[model samples]
Target chain A: MDYGWLMFCILLASWLGVELIAKIPSQLHTPLMSGTNAISGITLIGALVALAHTHEPLTEFLGYLGVFFSIINVFGGYWVTDRMLKMFNNKNNRK
Target chain B: MNTDIFYVISSILLIHGIKLLGKTATARKGNFISAFGMALAVAATLWQHPPQNILLTLTVALTGAYIGLLMAIKVQMTAMPEMVALFNGFGGMASVAVAIIEGIKLNYIPAIYYDTLIYFSLFTICLTLVVGGITFSGSLVAYGKLSRKLPTSSINFRGQEWVDVILFVLLLLSAYMWIFTHSVWSFYMLIALSFVGGCVFVLHIGGGDMPVIISLLNSLSGVAACAAGLILFNKVLIVAGCLVGTSGLILTLIMCKAMNRPVKKVLLGGFASISKNKQKSTRGTYKPISTEDAYYILEAAQTVAIVPGYGLAVAQAQHAVKDLAQKLTDNGADVFYAIHPVAGRMPGHMNILLAEADVDYDQMTELEPSNARFGNTDVAIVVGANDVVNPAAVENPDSPLYGMPILEVFNAKTVFVLKRGQGTGFSGLENELFFKDNVRMIYGDAKATLTQLSAEFKE
Candidate 1:
């Protein structure tokens, strides 16, 4: 795989995603930040891949820790965002 | 099986979910949809690469999830900012761990080095460690301040900017050595310096700048995750990381615009020095009002707007504020909250505070609309908020708050400020609104004063 092309794509996509975020109103910034923090938790996939490649004892230990921390970020982030978003009173939830 | 199909599907869902979050009505559903996407991605990954010790992996994942759930359930609304900060820290630390693991593997398993790929992989790994470590420690410091475990005031020293530059250069040097020499010691050194750099980077930013700091660290974590994905050649990870990183960067920029400062000025060192002229002379004294008198004014008012700030958090006055709003509503008075972009130390702090109080969501207004309403408002109640409503933001160009948009509460027919004393706000600038002829200051604890005012409505 050509690393240069892949990195360029990642940078471009990320820039576009941020442009989307800029369109959101400031009132929604808190939830958006929290929501995106949850999105960053996608690193759990990386940790899983690391664990799968575990060969040596030290490598295995690092992989385990990676998975552990990423799990916390992922599960914790989503749940917390859900909790916060639930409080956003709007017309749909007013009743 | 390529399993790439699952990656595509998950990425689409994640994007859709994030897009949905732009509106209040759909935000909650968006959160759930994103979570589902996350789960799908994780499940697919685990399915593709089933670990030899399934039990051990399961145990670790479950334990982590359980802890996260408990914390999310237990934390109060006011602590949400710090909780978000800590979560970002966790994400950064996780990426750092994964990057290190991948780096070790890359070094040990002499893989086919295609032109520049080896160099790119090594560079990304180093970048991940530096950025991830910084995000982790910086978020911790932010959490400490938000939670009152550490000083909320930005701690600055002589030659602080130079110190930061020196640390950053040293960090780059260490990372370079680790990459070229493959020396484990240099790698450890890089990690240590990265952590320290993160702390120093944020240490001098005052409490008022926390929302920006939090958002920036959130983005840094995203950058770290993306770098880790690059090192590991994980497409999904790379996509997700970019989404998060860019969004966070935009949020930081938004915050910087709200503060009327350049992003570079904020990152180099923030409003710590804005208060250096603390001995600035006061222009006029403020008039104090009793609760009964304030209530009478509020009662006679046809429209009222409440502006809350970090002071409300300190006084835990959100509930009382809500009750007061309800009473005003009961009296046939129009009531709404004016929320500044940077209000309450965190984004949407005022909204969540009011939400927790079960206030009608429609009653909350942003700065622009709220300012428009202020001209028609009969009474503007400043509740433990100072800087956001300070008229100096517009009237005095020399003021630090100048050019920053404010609530325009000073335009109201009558303004009543609820405070404990004649203290300046978090930014250390005295509010010109306080000394205005039409304004009245009600001195007391915010919660207690608000409770008293609410009782006056009952009378």
Candidate 2:
């Protein structure tokens, strides 16, 4: 896609984001934040591309750091969110 | 399926995943769907564009994933705010790494190619670097505050606002230099300035106002990612980043609204100074309640409202609180939790802490409704909470916390405040509720007080 097209997508997605997040209740705000944190780790793809296309020492090091950070962000964010969400279930049977 | 089509599918999953997260029944499934989408996106990227040095990439990625999962497992429920802040810092730094990698790649292209590309690459590269740096450092500051590594007080000095302005102006000038002359030093300067700018911006906000700053920084992290996506023209990154950016902004706005602060002032460190505004306008002194007397009073109360704050989690009293609530329930008292929007360090913090103790979400109530019901409540049992239940926020006009929404615990027939000592809250605002005639302060560690109160009920 061209630069202009990418900008358009960014704008559209932002509009989508506002609409998507506005409906969430205040009680679920924490999980919503954590869940989106994981989604931002989609930058892992960008990092992978950097590592794949470069052979320079600086690029390799930076690319590796990017991969590492994004990977943890993805796994940690999602898992932590899941763990938190697991606690929110209604357990009427509990004595 | 076309490899390109996989990106489309994953994007759909992400959008739908967030949509589901708003609902309690579907929230867990939403997390699962989002993770599944992320996995699919990663797999598609790996399959379509296999890395040249797969060994090194896998090693780093796997190691990161292991650490992330381990933290997710090991982190205490009460420490969720700090963990989330730390993760946000890593995500922010990741964007910086992505931007730097792209910037290096751009340096390889001929100078004429920069003009042909509309100077767009330079702008996105520079923007990504500054914003990413800001998010990383700002998030780290947030982490420090949440974890108590740094004092939770806002560190304000003379000319702090001027310093922020100067840094920002210099940052813009460097960005211009980087874009026009492609100077390497200008690029590095941008990085340094943004990181400093972030720390300075966040450092100026008061500890009580940290939840707002953290939310705003979380938004910045997403914007940085979006800029990185713009540099690479990646669809999935753009969608995910944009989604996170807007959502974080909305969350920040919601927090500001909840606290009755404007977005501009919150960012400008409007509430930074640790104000010592302790006005005792109410009649009568704070009367301490013995656990035995508290139990007698509680046992006879038919309706109870429990107002909890960050201190509840700090004292790890959630389980004790639940036990007391159960005891109250069995004693023919209807017990419910009253949650203030900005109750804990992060949004919904108290909910997570209480949920960890198996408290059903149904048992919890939000501010306005709980406020409306407190007038009818026989007793408002405030546990380890100060600022949120402070009557001064609404009663006294001169207070720093004035106009901020609070739990009107004084409206109840009897108010039992579980606190540690005579000190003020995080904002240093002396609780006006404590001095009210109906209010009885129970000074001690919250968990011990709750357990003892529960034991009294058992007798």
Using DockQ as the measure, the top candidate is 2
Compose the digit string of candidate 1's lDDT tens values, residues B1-459. 877898878887888888898888888888888888888888898898888689998999889889888888898887889999999998998888887787776666444443376778778989999999999899888888888898877788888768888998898898888677666777778878988987887777787888788999999988888888888888778888898888888888888888887888777555667678664544898999999999889999999999899888879899999999989999999999988989987777777778777877778888889988999999999988888888888888778788888889988999999999888787778888988999999999999999999998887
**Tens-digit lDDT string for candidate 2 (B244-340):** 9999999998998888888887777665453633355555588998999988899899999999988897898999999999999999999889999
**Over all chains combined, what TM-score does candidate 1 have?**
0.96
- What lDDT does each candidate get? 0.84, 0.85
Q: In model 2 chain B, which range of ten residues has the least summed lDDT? A: B272-281
The residue-level lDDT of candidate 2 at B440 comes to 92
Structure candidate 2, residue pairs in collision: none
List residue ranges in candidate 1 displaced over 4 A: A89-91, B106-115
Badly placed stretches (over 4 Å) of model 2 are A90-95, B108-112, B116-118, B274-284
DockQ of model 2 vs. true complex:
0.81
Model 2 earns a TM-score of 0.96
DockQ of each: 0.76, 0.81
Model 1 misses residue B384 by how many Å?
1.6
